[model samples]
Target: MNFKTKLLAYHAIAAAIAVIPMQSMASDVEIKYEKFPLTSPEAQQIWAAESNDATPLGEEKPWAMIAKVKVPGKKDLVVSQLFSSMHCGGIECPIKIMQEGLVISEGMACDAYEYHELSDDHEALMACDAIIPLDLK
Candidate 1:
C-alpha cells in the first residue's frame, strides 16, 4: 500500500503482460505447398487427401487452403486444396481441399501453412472436392 510497494506491483504486472502471448479468435487460414511424403502424421494425412488429378502446377507446389467455414459447436472445418492444377479456373481459382475429413481443432495452422500462406488460399483443403469455376468479374 506504500508508493514503493505499489510501483513494484505495477512493474510485475507489466512484465507478466509482456511475457504472455496475445490470443484472438482466428477466422481465416492458409498454408503453402511442400514436398510430399511429409514426415508428420498430420501432414501425411493432409497430403493423402489431395486430388491426384490436379495439374502439375497445382500438384507440384503452392498447395493452399482458404476456407472461412466453421461448423458451430463442433470444431471448425478443415480445408485443403490444389484446384487450379485439377484444371479449374476463374475468379478465386476454385481451389479446393478436404473438409471435416481434414478437420483441425481451433487455434492451429492448416497443413498448407507448411508451404507458406501469408494470406489464405484453398489449395490445402481441396482434395477429392468438386472443381467449380467462379466468375472473377
Candidate 2:
C-alpha cells in the first residue's frame, strides 16, 4: 500500500482503540485505613515481629499499630489494617506517627488486608503476601 493509505489506516485504528474502554484495567482502587485504638488490648500485643517483653515500643524495633476502619455509609462494614511499625507521635493521637518531619515506618509495606470484621475479634480471610508469617507475632 502507498504511504498515504498506510497513514490513514493507522489513524483509524488508533481512534477506534481510544473509544473502547479497557475492561481489564480498574478505574478506582483506592483504600484508606485509619489508626486503631492503641489503648485496646489487641493493639498492645502486635501481630508482626516479636519484641522482648522488657523492650518498650520504639526503644528497639518500630511498633506496629493496627487500624480500625469502616466502609463509608456502612455502619456494620469494617476492616483492619495490620500496619508495620510506627512510633506514637503524641498523647492525643498516640498512634499518629508522622513527626519530626520523619516517618519511622517509611518504605514499609502496609498490605491491603481482607478480614471478617467481628464484634469483638477479626478473622483473616486473605491478605497481601508481604504479611510476614502470614499474620503472626
Please report the candidate that would top lDDT against the real structure.
1
lDDT (tens digit, per residue) of candidate 1 on 26-129: 21443334333223354445554444544455355434344434433333443444333444343233333344464332222223333322112222222212
Model 1 vs. true fold: TM: 0.29
**Per-residue error (Å), model 1, residue 106:** 20
Runs off by more than 4 Å, candidate 1:
1-50, 58-62, 66-72, 92-137
lDDT of 1: 0.38
Instruction: List CA RMSD, all candidates.
Output: 13.7, 13.5
Question: What is each predicted model's overall lDDT from 0 to 1?
Answer: 0.38, 0.32
Clashing pairs in 2: none
Task: Tell me each candidate's TM-score.
Answer: 0.29, 0.23
Whole-model lDDT, model 2: 0.32
Local lDDT at 116 for model 2? 17
- Clash totals, every prediction: 29, 0
